[model samples]
Target chain A: GAGVSQSPSNKVTEKGKDVELRCDPISGHTALYWYRQSLGQGLEFLIYFQGNSAPDKSGLPSDRFSAERTGGSVSTLTIQRTQQEDSAVYLCASSLRDSSQPQHFGDGTRLSIL
Target chain B: QQQVKQSPQSLIVQKGGIPIINCAYENTAFDYFPWYQQFPGKGPALLIAIRPDVSEKKEGRFTISFNKSAKQFSLHIMDSQPGDSATYFCAAIKGGSYIPTFGRGTSLIVHP
Candidate 1:
């Protein structure tokens, strides 16, 4: 089966610009999560979506980082006014509704801010 | 406010050697612990997972030793190979929450 898919495997943008990263979770997956991995760092939680419930945005580093899951499927993570420090690999994962279920991850979109 | 803590930021071992990675968590509410392996330019894939009920679980060359009382767990790779070189992450998920707190990754390099 097709696993989680992410668009724009590599993205390069200028500072202060905006960039959008897309993720397509596996079919029938009800839980989606977004994470950021900086150089030599761990995965930083960004946001989470499950079914129709409200998303948990507490992990979002700043207001400039926002994400939206429309129709309970595809998700888009947008970073506004990008900064040099914003450069990192954005990863998306999906899993069954159960919290104990293992999550499947996409290759991720590497965003570079110059 | 990091719930899960991992040690040994990096490790290097011979092809036939065993490499161990450890993780500790403060939250007892966490019921599931999973380890993920990621290679360069690739997403992480689930290596093995264990529940609080079991003290250890082994699949293939990977074994997860979990200590519920001590709130700690470790991944032991038996006879690791150069192909096993990658970044490993440990994560714990609460019973009802969809989010899983991840620990700092361990970069493992096995020389053949």
Candidate 2:
């Protein structure tokens, strides 16, 4: 079975540009999460989606960051007006509906804002 | 507030040695603890996990020693090898929340 996967294994863009990162969760996984790992830093929570219900966007840093999960499978994270501070590896993970289950992670998309 | 705190940013051990990574959490609600391993250019994978009800769990050469009252936990790797070199993360979850709070990762290197 295919695990979670992200698009554009690597991406580079200029400051003030917008970047959209995509994630495809494992089959039948109803829970999906997005996280950011900066250099020498821990994983920072971003947004999470469970089924068709409202997402938990509490972890989103600011209004410029947003995400949407469509049809309960694919998710896209959009960072508007990217800044050098946005340079980090964006990770996506998925798990079964239960909270106790282990999460499966994707290789992540490394975004470099120059 | 960061719920979980991990220490010893990195560790180096010789082959056949024991390597231990520790983590502490401030949240008492956390009942499930898990450890994840990540290699270069790869995603994190679950290594071992334990719930509050269990004091310890051992799977092959990996063992998780959990202390529920102290809110502290540790992962012990026996007979460490170079292949075990990677970043390790400790995570915990509270109640029914699906998202788990992760700790500052620890990079472990085993030398032969």
Candidate 3:
């Protein structure tokens, strides 16, 4: 409600199974971002959405990773045929402006591929 | 290449000690720098930020020292406490770009 919200706080799935992670951004926030964080590693940018412009998917690691922001409010990140390497904490953030503004983050969804 | 480089993957300090985390960047276009703190099982939250125009900024016990010439910046915690233990991240962002480059993060432990 007041902050960026992510669903499925923890998800454990078998390898090769598909999964979808959801993010509900703060009200009136026009920018949303997705990132992957490995154990004791830096955040790897996954995708970015600004207003109505086309999402910047350049940081996606593979074709299996895709995301979409519907109605400019909520977004979902989907991984197809997940592999063990895909196991990581998927973080979501929302900002009033773009990168120039501070982002509010949610307690990310921890996705495990077993 | 990692645009932002952070040092000391892990650190430990006694209560009331000062712990500093360093980060460096190679991008000249980066104008905004921010630090985030994340606790166990939680995402990072913006702690403090400084622009290139200012050399340093202070908020509470957290201080950010920026050196534009060296393209390096550091975060200092004054009188750190056990409650301050967490992972810290340094990020650099350029104007007109939506993507922000983040450092590998530093894990700090303030022991009581």
- Cα lDDT tens digits for candidate 3, A1-114: 988999999999999999999999999999999999999789999999999999999999999999999999999999999999999999999999797788999999999999
- What is the per-residue lDDT of model 3 for residues B1-112, given as tens digits with 9 covering 90 to 100? 9899998899999999999999999889999999999999998999999999999999999999999999999999999999999999999988778788999999999999
Query: Which candidate number maximizes lDDT?
Result: 3
Interface RMSD of 3: 0.7
Rank by DockQ (best first): 3, 1, 2
| Cα displacement (Å) at residue B15, model 2 | 1.0
Give me candidate 2's interface root-mean-square deviation. Answer: 1.2
Please give, for residues A40-102, the per-residue lDDT of candidate 1 as tens digits. Answer: 778998999999999989999999999999999999999999999999999999998855788
Q: List the residue pairs that clash in candidate 3.
A: none
Worst 10 contiguous positions by lDDT, candidate 2 chain A? A95-104
| Displacement of the residue B84 alpha carbon in candidate 3, Å | 0.5
Interface RMSD of 1: 1.2
Looking only at chain A, give the TM-score of model 3 against the true structure. Answer: 0.99
DockQ, all models: 0.77, 0.76, 0.87
Least accurate stretch of 10 residues (summed lDDT) in model 1 chain A?
A95-104
- Using lDDT as the measure, what is the rank order of every candidate, best first? 3, 1, 2
- Candidate 1 vs 2: which has more lDDT: 1
lDDT of each: 0.93, 0.92, 0.95
- What is candidate 2's lDDT per residue for A49-109, written digit by digit as tens? 9898999999999999999999999999999999999999999999988558889999999
